[model samples]
Target: MTCFSPKFMAFCAALACLSGQAPADTAQGAHVSIELNALEPIEDACRISFLVQNGHDTDIEQAVYEAVLFDTEGRVDRLTLFDFGALPAARPRVRQFLVPGLSCADLGRLLINGVETCTGDGIPADACTDGLELQSRADVEVLG
Candidate 1:
């Protein structure tokens, strides 16, 4: 019982151009990261899940998850959220979906962010705010 949507990617794309003390660039493409999973065929074959961390230490209090589709031409097409049969909390929550032939790279990171939140100390002045993780197989997919 979780909420999902495709509109979240729009938010991530906007965060990409930002440059400040903390950069959301760890995601490799945008300020967000996409995680693809293989699930047992209990229901759908296209098992996809996403985990989004604030690329920066801006203190993201809440946000929603989504699935975004991209073509070979580099166009973005947002897909519909799966019918989990329940609504997710109006905050940062985990969500999963089942899409058809979503390939391996057609998806992007989930977008979870609080609309109105108090900014933190803007990261420590002396501490190196940059952090990163190795890109695993679950991170992305490429559509043919």
Candidate 2:
């Protein structure tokens, strides 16, 4: 028979317990993280890029979010819908939107107001919105 010390057995038990538990961030539930990846000025318009990641086990056939843009003075600039189509499970995708007549310099913040539509097989209706995490890499702030 193989021999294992008492301390080694205790360590093995701890490791087994940890392997069964999910990460701290995903312990609550699956989440969709949207990160404002970048903003670029292109010919009098701003190209906004978002890095989206689906943490769930099911693929999202369609995902749209109502977004609100704020100016430097914190005044609402505009509202629009961003369509991030076909988010595969546990995969990250970058989606870009070009806003006409808007400059990246004038943008203060972008808020994910709500989920306009989230549809997929065997997925919760609120899977895209619930426990959503918003982050920013550009100068503009992003909120959920």
Candidate 3:
């Protein structure tokens, strides 16, 4: 299952894409961004692995659970529209999600957990707009 809910996740995704944040009262709070970078295709089981970035202005003290992908064909009931995990990286933080048996070919999105955090120390607080990026061709070659 993906973190984004199919029935309503599209609405959330749209808000995030337009406003750079989940929709108003999305339960994702404010002043946060999720950038789904690379979704590297894996042949064996999953379609691809992802690299997500979580950012805030301050620091993350408590642990918040988050998930990526949102939805898939068969993986829905198995997992859930939302996965649970903790955010270890605080502000000025960019964490990567390495989902083993998951794919991102169809969906250009990754999973992320956002429960607790403080403003990070990345220059101008607003300067950090949590963004995601795909793995570079060079990096993929090295990993391959």
Candidate 4:
């Protein structure tokens, strides 16, 4: 099952930022990309699913992704997703996050904040050391 917890997201947010890298930055030596696949309204909240593709020569054992949803009034909400198991090289892994009580109409933009803890090929490295080319989605609309 998908793990949906703000505390975990907060922890990831702290750990990822502590490494001294901007969320928009990509990890060097790691060919990884993020794509937002869906953003739909559910009740009062919205659900977002996306893919994390590994293009490097090594496998990705785990990753913590943080994203921010912004509204027109400047209210910001954080949505986080993670794959703590394994993501093979040149493959894609799908993950999802939920923004509680947030409507799709309220979303103005989506930003991929950062990626945390990338381990593979029997080594742990900083994926965001060189800055990532963030794949952010704008001009998005929710359809019923």
Model 2: CA > 4 A from native: 1-25
lDDT of 4 by residue, 1-144 (tens): 222486665554345445432222222434556666677788878776665565555676776655566775656655554443576665556777667887877777766556656666653476422334445353452111
RMSD from true fold, candidate 2: 7.3
Off by over 4 Å in 1: 1-30, 44-46, 65-78, 81-95, 98-144
| Candidate 4 root-mean-square deviation in Å | 14.3
Per-residue lDDT of candidate 3, residues 41-134 (tens digit): 5663343323223434334333233333434342331221222133323222344444555444444323343323333344333322333222
Which ranges in model 4 have alpha carbons more than 4 Å from their true place?
1-30, 79-85, 128-131, 136-144
Give the root-mean-square deviation of each candidate in angstroms. 14.7, 7.3, 13.1, 14.3
Best by TM-score: 2
- For model 3, what is the alpha-carbon lDDT of residue 108? 32
- Give the winner by lDDT: 2
lDDT of residue 3 for candidate 4: 23
lDDT of 2 by residue, 1-144 (tens): 222786665565345334542122334457788989999999999999998888787899999999999999999999999999999886678999999999899999999999999999999988999899899999898988
TM-score to native of every candidate shown: 0.31, 0.82, 0.34, 0.61
Model 1 error, position 83 (Å): 12
Off by over 4 Å in 3: 1-30, 42-57, 68-92, 106-144
Candidate 2 positional error at 87, Å: 0.2
The superposed Cα distance between candidate 3 and the true structure at residue 55, in angstroms, equals 7.1
